[model samples]
Target chain A: MLKKYGIRKGFIAALFLNNSIDFISIFFALIEIGATPIPVNMAFRAIELDEIFSNADPHAVITEKDHLKVIMKYLSGRIVVERNGGNFLMRDSGAGGFGRGPAEVDHSIATINYTYRGYGYPLGAMVPHIQYLFGSELLQEAVRLDAGERLLVVLPMPHIFTLIGCIFLPLIYGITPVISRSRNPLRLFETVHAYQIQNILAVPELYELLYKFRDSAGDCTPLNAFLSGGSVMPDEMYGRLVDEFDVDLIHGYGLTEFTPVSRNIRGDIRPGTIGMVCDGLEYKIDPCDEFGFGEILIRTENMTKAYYRRSAESRDVFQNGWFRTGDIGRVEDGHLIFKREKKKTRKVKGNMVDLLEVQRILMEYPKMRNAIIECNDSILSAAVEIDSARNFDSEVLSIKKFLEDRIAGYKIPKIFSRI
Target chain B: MKDNKITTVDADNLRESIIKTLAVIARINEKEINDSILIKDELGIDSIMSLEIIANIEKRYNIQINEEDTMNITTVGEFIDYVIHIINKK
Candidate 1:
């Protein structure tokens, strides 16, 4: 089908669809054909999708049936294909194709992983296939996921956290990952209890939802350990999962450019720190200037070469075989301590404030669904989605006090509105 | 000197091409559309598709349509009028 569309080697193919078993085959097939795959987040609305389409200029776009209509509109003068997902993935290509050893499909540029999180324009890092192998193997060595480990994957497929933790790690260790198409939290918990699943890897939000409804688990649950990344786990939730719920929860660190960078060992961990650096990678922190904080940089054996279509931008960071992560952190007691994300920080009244740090603190607040802080035209404001559990006006009042208590007054958004 | 003649083209001919293109885009027949149809509701012309239709019109007519004007034209008939006005102005 790609050949019919005139997509040759060294071309870019946009993978704009939700998570499913089919995502695995389509992703590898594109890699096997030597074309780089750019996995577009399915949750992006029109404006966000428009930004990515212009940024990556793909030769062809493969999307789910429902996403076809929307994705086609964004693509101009481009080939589009639809995938039905799940069992249809295993069905023959209808072309009756040929062969290549899975291990031999290495060292080629695999994907331009879209890792941007801020409200700004999307940016992708060019990751080679070797990075995927090294990162996944590093995880397999640390976690020791046995062949019998029944893990349920809940995070979105496009995220680096999910790709390393759920997909590649399991495949490398000969463990079968239970890929669920359902997005409902209830169905996920049901799958865990019903399937006798052992391990879970998810973002902090999903863990919080399960914690909120802990009674749903009742007495008998098959879950043994939980691994979390993409964000720091709140202390309250961490304690509840470990002390009350009797599940092992560990904090891991990863970025889209390189994943499974560092993950806490099963039994050895410390609070307020993202675990020790994984094998085959070295990390360092710059000397603090007038403060106990410095930027974190890493020299990895298999880190991405540069940003896609933005070589000059990468030059500012990738120098002397060291990649400067725009993350501010410090080393304390031999563990990496996260201070704030540099990209999301803004200067307010001569003080630097991290929007992501504020968003993380505001997300788990009472009656708050989600909080997004953005700097638009040099003005910082927060769009807080208030849960309908309480009166809208009253929730706004409580949220102000909540922000005042947790963050600096200058860091608080000048305008707060319910989304 | 007489070679530059602005031959007035047939309005129905241009309108026919527009209708056919719209039918192909909406995946419906030209018979289903008329002067009173709301493109947003009847044809499901989403925001991105609206830009796509504008691009198609520009390609087919060999002319450029102002994007700002395209946003305000909601109905199918209005889109046709906007294209005709741009061509006639030339």
Candidate 2:
């Protein structure tokens, strides 16, 4: 079906789990035949969907029957894979068949992921061919994944980081990946126990839930390692996991732009550091004097070619052959330690304050379990969740008093809420 | 008696009903429960537990409690009264 539509050239494919497993199967089969697959996130709303499709301009879009009306309105000259029945149509394109052998082409742009909330950049990031190859190779070398390893992937497939690290990397090494459609905590644990999953790749939020389940279960089954990304892993939670489960918690730093950059390979892992850069990737810190933290610039063979259609916007960040990650980090003794990004910083009384620092400080209080520091241009506010049945007001007041002495009065949070 | 008046059920009866309802819903031990117990605090019942309790109580008693009635229930006594009021209605 793919070859008949001249989709032999690398193309983007849209897949929603409900109606498009057949399309996905065929898409993976195409990948085996050297056709690049662009997997779109099903979570995208109409406005966000239009922006991505307009920018990417994929050669073909494979969608389910339910999403056909909305997708067909925006896309033209494409192939539609219907999921309701076993009917496939190559719309506006001719010539179809399979197996023409692998085409030797430069792995320029393999896939494009759209960012959430349209915050950082319009098109999230592009994964080039070389980067995927190098990243998969680097992860394979670092993790020592065997063909018999059972990997539990808890994150959504559309997320670029999970796509490469958990899904593609495992496929590359011939490891079996157990993909669960449900995120229900009990069901997730059932899947783990049922499959005897040894390796897990998940976000910090899912890790927290799993930790609670493990505590309740009493008897602990050792997982090889828990790989976390997508958000900052709280230090206290990291410590608890190590103490209780005796499992090494590995952290990787990557975004939609650079799929998988750095990973804590050996179990001798640092809690807060993102570890060394992946092989075949070059990184440097942008100049900053205050905290020795700067924008992380990465130059790699796998860096995205360009923003699909936003040439002018792409040029702003992609300068002099290096892609500006907008993430702030400090290189400590050769390892890249990621701090909060500059955009997350706030200015008070002409003094700059890092929100992550405030969060870390609040997390130190015994009563507080989780904290998020949110700041607008003028005022900074904090939301904290405490252990069940604990009074958070006293803790919040104490934190405020402590900050008053250490930081400027203006830097202290103006409002605090128990969430 | 008024149509919506809850019958003055004794503590033993309330305790038996509550325990049976909770056990049926969550497969938890009902014998350990008491009238003075806080459903969440004493039982280590989280929000999911509360949701299951609400569903089971409605099905067993053939009664429906509004969101407002459930929100006001902080203690097991109040939860009993809330369920009785809904059951008495029908």
Candidate 3:
């Protein structure tokens, strides 16, 4: 099957797919054949998609037929492989072969997952196969989920949390990963009950909805543990999940650069803290303040050395064999207690929204002079300085309309004001 | 010109337009959207998508839908009706 598509060693393929068996199968197949697969965010619109293609420049794109209309223009001369049964429909734009395949082809790097640095464009984190192989085992030791247990995977698979915690970990640990298509709360409950899922690793936002829907529906489905990560789990929310739902909510922390940096121990659980750093990983708090809080730095064997195609930014984060997490925290009783992000980032619905990234895109507005985006009370709003000749009302609408096309709907600033 | 008042004819037209708009945003066939169809459960509209839908409607109609109004809407029919009401009030 891979032969027919001309997918060979060192071939770079972009997977623009949802959470399904096909996504996993394609990913594994690419890895098996020594190819690098980049899992694209399903929510990405044309502009986001274009930015990724421009950077990664994958030889081919594997996506469903529904997304064809949106990505057709970006295809250019690349191959488009549709996940349609036995007969794979491959579209070639007649611009010679696939593409100028990866020049050097560093075999150590497994997958290049795109992530934000709280500013500028997103950088692709080049993780190796060894990381998932080893990190999953470390995570398994912490979470302690047995093989054959059904693990509900409701989050988007492209993100590091879901990719590692849900997909890779399950695959490596021999656990059953049941991927849910929708983030709808009722549907999530339905999937949990229907599959008899014993475990779930999700973001805080889903847990919040599950609590709401579970309470309203009066569901009593049994589960082993609710593993929370991707974003900081509120102390109150953590308490509610454990006390109200009567379930153990295991909270952990990590980044796309490195998976499972730290995870709470199974028996020795803490409500707010991210718990001990994962075994085999080294962590240190640099520049400790008077209150004992500082930027958490992690050095792991499995961590990515540099961001792919981003030398300067990668150099900035990676220092002396340690990855600057950009997360402020302090060690309390040997547990890594997260304080707050030292970077210009905010979590909206558990997804990191880069304020600088938004501001950078806002500056692209032809009418705009300057823009500042900030999140207050969990609501993202932007204050802009535009030309005085332009009507404020029309410019706000135009800027929003411009942003809606570039970024995800959730990342869009809700309120706009002229400065 | 923006219409501040929606008459009976205007309301009907507006409702149809909203249904069409939502169908496109939700990526569902227009025929599939009905009164009983659950917005979140059936259409798979999350908080983000819901906000996007409201933003699109507000942009088109030049009207604002508050957070409270958004909370009150659950079904496709209710959302269409609420938008129509808001348009009428506008």
Please name the candidate that would achieve the greatest TM-score relative to the true structure. Answer: 3
Q: What is the per-residue lDDT of model 3 for residues A339-397, given as tens digits with 9 covering 90 to 100? A: 78888877777777778878888898896788889888556889999876777765665
> Whole-model Cα lDDT per candidate?
0.67, 0.63, 0.78
Best by lDDT: 3
Model 2: C-alpha RMSD to truth?
A: 13.1
Candidate 2 ranges with C-alpha deviation above 4 Å: A4-11, A18-24, A30-36, A66-72, A75-77, A84-107, A116-121, A216-222, A343-419, B1-90
**Predictions ranked by lDDT, top down?**
3, 1, 2
lDDT score, candidate 2, position A337: 84
Residues A110-202, candidate 2, lDDT per residue (tens digit)? 655664212322464556766666777877766777888888866657666667776678778987788765544555666777888878887
Specify the CAPRI tier of model 2. Answer: incorrect
DockQ of 3: 0.06
Which residue pairs clash in candidate 2? A4-A95, A4-A96, A131-A302
TM-score of chain A by itself in each prediction: 0.77, 0.72, 0.94
| Model 1 lDDT per residue over A1-419, tens place | 55655555666778876777778887877887787788876655444466567777676677776666566565555555667743222222232222211221124678887654342445667887878888888776656667877888877788777787787888888777887655344456668777778788877656765665565555535667787887766677788877645776777777777876677777777767787787678888765656657888888868886776666667876878888777888777657777766776554422335576667667868767778888653346789887577776456556655664344444556556777
Q: Which stretches of candidate 3 lie over 4 Å from their true place?
A: A84-87, A388-394, B1-78, B81-90
| Residue A245 displacement (Å), model 2 | 2.2
Pairwise TM-score winner, candidates 1 and 2: 1
Interface RMSD of each: 18.1, 11.1, 10.6
Looking at model 2, residue B43 earns an lDDT score of 46
